[model samples]
Target: MRIGLLSFAHVHAEHYQALLRSMPGVELVGFWDDSVHAQSYAERYALKQYLTPQLLLAQALDAVIVCSETSRHREVVELSARAGVHVLCEKPIACTLEDAEAMRDVCAQHGVTFMTAFPMRFDPSCGELRQAVHSGQLGSILGVNGVNHSENPSVHRSWFANPALSGGGAVMDHVVHLTDLLRWCFACEVAEVYAALQWTDGAGENGTALDTAGIVLLTLTNGVQASIDCSWSRPATYPRWGHLKLDVIGTDSLMVIDAFADHLTVYPPDLTRPVQWLGFGVDPNQAMLTAFLDAVQRRQPPPVSWQDGYEATRVVLAAYTSAQQGRPVRLRPARCESTEDPGDGQGS
Candidate 1:
């Protein structure tokens, strides 16, 4: 299948490009990006460059991965949908609920599949735990506590700290991953949200004000309580970009997930930068892409539907609202419109 990349602004775009090129039976037709760095990246990767997204769409591509900044997702997805191209959008679907709805509506109207790029769902550890929960191994779930802590993203991309560009700070970047995980494992929606936010280490603002650390507490529809630490408080010297862990409390047994637990840690002889951790596990991104490709090729709906993306975004937005209001915010149960094979919502 022929596939095009919509943007190269997100750091993951480079990795996704490599995956697309390496995957069998898939063609990375080309990519489009208006950023000044686009030419250098395209040249270094020997990639075809499209001056405008329209030209890339004119290639009659089968699907496009939209990895633009958080705020640019709606525009790119709408364009791809209009061109009859399925979309696999990066998470935190949009900066706002309204934008997320618009993207969902447009894709549905155009009759193209829309999948959220939520790689955690494909993580072997997360998938196995979710399966155990669904198969009644966990008996009755009591509560879930998850941590999605990461190094300050501004160290790599300054846009991540800008609210206008990224929606919020660490909360915006990390909340959706765990929220989607909880929803997938429990098969329920967030019924209410409460959050507490803070800015520490003198990490100042980026264009718009942003919180550097936060914790969100949520109550799911099935009476299960969940808490997420969506903080960017990891030190710069940390080995990996970030790590996710979910602790599931249940009546029968407790299950824990270390999403990137397959890693070897090393202490270097050099004192200056001594610690290094190497990951040696199946690439969850590859698994997610494969699922999306299968859906596109088989003319079946994607595993992660637009409604799933919208609901995840909604929960995150509500967290922000609760933080700002200094109180709990109630969320109405979301209505799912598609009968897609959810398959545990690996992509989001």
Candidate 2:
């Protein structure tokens, strides 16, 4: 299948480009990005670089992988859908629920498959925990706790800090990953959220709008309570780029996921870190992209639906709202409204 990249502004764009080129069924037709750095990276990687979206769509590619800024996701997805190209857009669909809904509606109207890039769902550790919950090994899930921490305060791109460009803050950027995980594991929706956020005025060379240090309390629709502690204040000397840990407790047993350790440890009075390790050695981005392509090829829905993306976005947006208000915020049900049609304009 012919594949094209909508934008290279996202850090993961290079990985996607490499994955597309390496995957057996995909051909990297070209890439389009407004950023000079993104264009330079595309040229260095030897991929065709397009100067405009019109040029990229003209390629008549089977799908477009969007790794643009979080705020620009709606525009890219809408444009791709209008061009009759399936889309695999990176997470945090848009800065607002309204835009996210618009993107979904456009894709549906155009009959183009839409998938959000959430690779954590495909992680081996996550997979095992999901299976444990589904198999009744964990009984009825009662509570969940998660932590996503990183020391890298420096963002190569400036948008990472601007609320207008990248959304609220680190919470908006990183919390979506955990929200998506919780949704997939429990099949539950976040009914309400209470949070506390902190920011540092001391500027690190990285111009970050806020250093993500916060705590979030979540009440799920199924009466399960969950908490997420997200921070970017870890000492720079820390070995890992980031840490993702989840503890899911049920009536009878509990499952702990340590993605950093690449293992799932279950506790049944005694903590039993599984003796056998399941390695998610495959490139998550590649795997997700391939799944999107397969859905397009088979005329089936994408693995992660647009509604899933909207739901996840709702959770993150709620956390931001709650944190800012210093009180709990109840989330409304997800909804989409159609917009006036924009005719497809094609060139890559």
Candidate 3:
């Protein structure tokens, strides 16, 4: 499979770049990045850097990973679809519902595969948890509590806090993962959302304070209530980058999963930043890429579809709305069936 990366803006681009290079029978056809980091990436990867997306897409590529800024997702997806190339877009699909829907629609109209970048779906632990929940080992799921917290992403990429670029802050960045997981495991969509937000001391590009922390309460269509606690509260001195954990409560039993549990804590000689965590385990990103490649090779739809991303985005937006209105906000019926997994495996 011949594939190229649309941009190097997202942090995950580095992992995907390396994974693509290591995969058998796959060609990582360089990348197109509009940032200053593009030159360094071109040098490190030993791949030619295209000056613009048009120059890169003209390479007769089979697929592309859209890792551009959240707001530019629609533009890149539209371009790739028109060029007859399949897409694997980064999460929070877009800054708004209109843009996200447009990306999905364009891919469908062009008859190209469109997959959402939700790597957690491929995490072995998450997979096991999903199996246990779906199998009845959990009897009847009562409720769930999920936490996905991280250091301020803006510290790494300033765009993360910019509402124009990222749509919102912590809620926009972290809410989708758990929302998608809830939908994936429970086979339902969020029916209502009630949320509270905490903002950062500083403002973004336009004096608009971004939510640095959020607590979202969700009611699923299948009669399940779930709570997600997401924040950019981790300090830089922490041993690990962040965490993803979920506690599933069922009538028969409770299942808890800590995705980054397999790791070692190292105390470095440098006192400035003496301690850090070294995660040691299978790379979920690699598994996700493999699944994507397998689907493309066999002409099968990807396991994570555009609808999954779209639905997850809806939940995040509803949380913001709920917070602003100071009341629970009800969402529209999901396009996916309530009894089935949210992702229909239809790449298009």
Candidate 4:
């Protein structure tokens, strides 16, 4: 399979590039990025750097990973879809619901697959949790508590703090991942959203405050209550670059899974990073890419569909609306791959 990257702007693009190159039978065709760092990436990776996305698409590529800034996703996805290439777009889908809808619609119109970059669905711990819930081991879920925190992304990319470029701040960056996972694991969609956000200093002007921290409360279609504590509150001196944990409360039992729990941590940290955490395991990103590639090779739709991306974006957008309006934002149930909505979802 021939695949190239559309942009190297996202921090994860380098990892994806390396994974693509190292994976067997997969050709990492190179990348396209107009940023000044493009040349350095080409030199570092020893891969061709296409001057324009069109030139990259002209190489008869099967697909491209769209890792551009949050706001640029629409234009790039459109370009790739028009060129008849499948897309694996970075999360939060887009800055606005309209843009996310447009991207999904265009890909559908062009008959190309649109897979959301939601690797959490492939995480080993998350998968086990899903099984426990589905197999009746968790027995009647009551509520959920999820936390996804990371060091301020502005340190990695300045665009992350610029609302015009990366959308809302920490909330936009982290909300969709947990949202997608919750919807996937519970076999439902967000029926309503109520959020409270803490803004960055001096950024509250014109209602454009960049969210530094937030707690988003969601009521799912099946009436399971879930709360996500999403923030960029981790300091540079922290032991890890990120954190993702989920606790599922059930009538008969409780389940907890931390994505970083199984890793080995070195005390005398490496000089390059704040801490050294190592593991011999399959990363979620690699698994997600493999799933996407398998579908592409088989000429089948991707496992993670466009509607997955759309509804995730919807939840994020709804969270912002709830925060701005100072009340819960009720979401109309989406017509996606969701399970049959249990009428008036009775739960603990």
Report clash pairs, candidate 3: none
User: How many angstroms is residue 65 displaced in model 4 relative to the true structure, after the best TM-score fit?
Assistant: 0.6
Q: Once model 4 is optimally superposed onto the true structure by TM-score, how far is the C-alpha of residue 33 displaced, in angstroms?
A: 0.8
Worst window of 10 by summed lDDT in candidate 4: 339-348
Give the TM-score (vs. native) of candidate 1. Answer: 0.94
TM-score for all models, in order of appearance: 0.94, 0.86, 0.94, 0.92
Model 3 stretches with alpha carbons more than 4 Å out: 270-272, 336-348
Candidate 4 has an lDDT of 0.85
lDDT of each: 0.87, 0.76, 0.86, 0.85
- Model 2 TM-score is 0.86
- lDDT per residue for candidate 1 within 236-303, as digits (tens), equals 89888889999999899999998888889988787777487888889999999998998888888788
lDDT string for model 4 (1-348, tens) is 999899988989998998898899999998999998889999999999999999999999999999999899999999999999999999878988789878878887888878888887888888898889889998889999999999987777778888888878888899999998898888888999999999877543344557989999999999899999999988878776788999999988899988887678777645765566665586888888988887778776676777777788889889888999999999986766422122111110
Higher-lDDT candidate of 2 and 3: 3
- Evaluated at residue 49, the lDDT of candidate 4 is 94
Model 1: residue 50 alpha-carbon error in angstroms: 1.3
Candidate 4: list runs displaced more than 4 Å: 202-208, 267-273, 337-348
Total backbone collisions for each predicted model: 2, 2, 0, 0
For lDDT, candidate 1 versus 4, the one ahead is 1
